[model samples]
Target: MKIGLYFGSFNPIHIGHLVIANHLVEHSDLDQIWFVVTPHNPFKKKSSLLDNYQRLEMVYRATKDYPKLQPSDIEFNLPQPNYTINTLVYLQEKHPDYKFSLIMGEDNLKSFHKWKNYELILENHHIYVYPRLSKGHVETQFDNHKKIHHIDAPIMELSSTFIRSAIKAGKNIQPMLPQHVWEYLDEMNFYK
Candidate 1:
């Protein structure tokens, strides 16, 4: 089976995340997509992040109805300061029969070279990139472009930052997030 690892700090899983997962499953050859909720992303700041377990629960709630999309807290068990290479290696070892690839937005693709062991990752796995504002920049730099498949998935303007800000401003973030995720965040009074 081929699994696409949609790695992210799902502070509170939103509809945007679900849209990408659904698109990948429906349009691509991928068999499943695992929302690998990271405790800490090396490239991102930690101050804005919610608790890993809480974030994982939000992802779980968001993806519960989709059998092809799963919420995985795999990085939580790994060492702190989770790196994609480390997670990939561990996952490869654990599930020897299944193949894994990366599913990321074009914005992330631009700075992907700076990631730890990025060359090895590019060499070993296929990267499914969705078109964002940074697509042109990434396409220009990458010489071996065949490894990257640019997908025309729904472009979502909604982000975790927007969600957080909405909650902080006492605005309605219910529409920004999945129904169950919104319920969970409201119940916990998260981001307040």
Candidate 2:
């Protein structure tokens, strides 16, 4: 099976994430999309992030109804400060028959070259890029790269940071999250 690894912190899974994953599976050739919930993101601060298992629970709730979209906590057991390359390598070893690819936004593609062993990753796996409302140019090297594919998915401006802040301020961000995910966060009183 061809799996698209959509890695993220998923502090609390939201509708925007589901939309992207659903769109990709339905529109693209990918067979499934695994939401690889990272324990810690190298570019993000860990202070505002929720517990790894808690965040994973939210993801599980959000994607329960979608068979094509599944939640993954594969990075939790890996060493801290882990990179995409390490995850890719580990996944390949465990499931050599499955073709794994990356699912990222254009914003991430802009700085992808700086990622650890990016060249190696490009050489081994395909990267599916979605649109995002962000500034800066992608490196010319990746513009027409055969291994990189720009998918015309929805440009999701919604972010976990914005949702977290809204909840803390007593705002009704219910519609922004999946029904089950919203209920879970509300019951746990997270970010508030």
Candidate 3:
């Protein structure tokens, strides 16, 4: 089975995240997309993040109806400050039958070199790069690499930060989040 690993903190799952996952599943060769909820992103601050289990639950609520989109809590049991390379290695060892690829935004590709063992990731797995809101193009050294592919997925400017801010201000964020996720957020009074 060919699986695409879409890694993120998903502090709260939003429609933008869903759109990208759906787009990739429908348009790309990937059979399924696993939303790997990172316990702690090495590049992001942990203080602002919700509990790993809480974030994972939100992901489950948001993607419950989507057959191709699945939430993974694999990072929760792994070491803190989750590194993509380590997770990929572990996943390969555990699920050797599955062929895994990475799904990332062009913006992340710009900083790809800074990731731990990035070269190893490129050597072992393919990367599907979706466009994002950015002023300039990503200048990657692997532009012509066979393992890297540029996909024409829609670019959504909506972010978890914007959603959190809206919730704090008591603004209507219904359009930005999945229905179940919004209901869950409202019931839990998250980010308030």
Candidate 4:
């Protein structure tokens, strides 16, 4: 099986996430898309993130209906300050038959060189890149890298940050979220 690992905090899973994952899975050869919910991202602040289980629950709610999309808590058990290389290695070890690729934004690709053992990662797995409205430049080497593919997926500017802020400000962020995720957040009174 060809699985695309779409890693994120999913502080709350929103529509933008679905659209991109759906588009990629449906358009590409990937058989499934896994939303690898990170327990801790070295680049982001831990305090701002919700509990791991809560975030995972939201992901479950958002992706339940989509058979092609599934949520994974693989990072939850791994050592904190999670790194992509470690997860990739662990996954490869467990699922030898599965061809796993990365699903990341073009902005992340720009900083791909800075990741741990990035060279090794590039050697082993393919990376599917989506467009993002961020400012930065991709390294010249990655521009034509065979393992890195830049797909013309829709540019979804809606962010979990924006949704969280809106909910805190008592704004209606329902439309931005999957119905069940919104209901889950509302029922739990999260981000308020």
lDDT of candidate 1? Answer: 0.87
lDDT of 4 by residue, 81-118 (tens): 77899999999999999999999998788778899999
Q: In each prediction, how many residue pairs overlap at the backbone (N, C-alpha, C within less than 3 A)? A: 0, 0, 0, 0
- Rank by TM-score (best first): 3, 2, 4, 1
Question: lDDT per model, in order?
Answer: 0.87, 0.91, 0.91, 0.91
Residue lDDT tens for model 2, 41-96: 55676777898899999999999999999999999899878889999999999999
User: Residue 9, candidate 3: how far off, in angstroms?
Assistant: 0.9
Every model's TM-score? 0.92, 0.94, 0.94, 0.94
TM-score of 1: 0.92
lDDT of 3 by residue, 1-192 (tens): 889999998978899999999999999899999999987655666676888888999999998999999999988898776689999999999999999999999988888999999999999999999998777775778789999999999988888998898889989999899999999888988999
Number of backbone clashes in candidate 2: 0
Measured over all alpha carbons after superposition, the RMSD of each candidate to the real structure, in angstroms, is 2.3, 2.1, 1.9, 2.1
Off by over 4 Å in 1: 41-47, 134-138
| Clash pairs detected, candidate 4 | none
Q: Is candidate 1 or candidate 2 better by TM-score?
A: 2
For lDDT, the strongest prediction is 2
Off by over 4 Å in 2: 41-45, 135-139
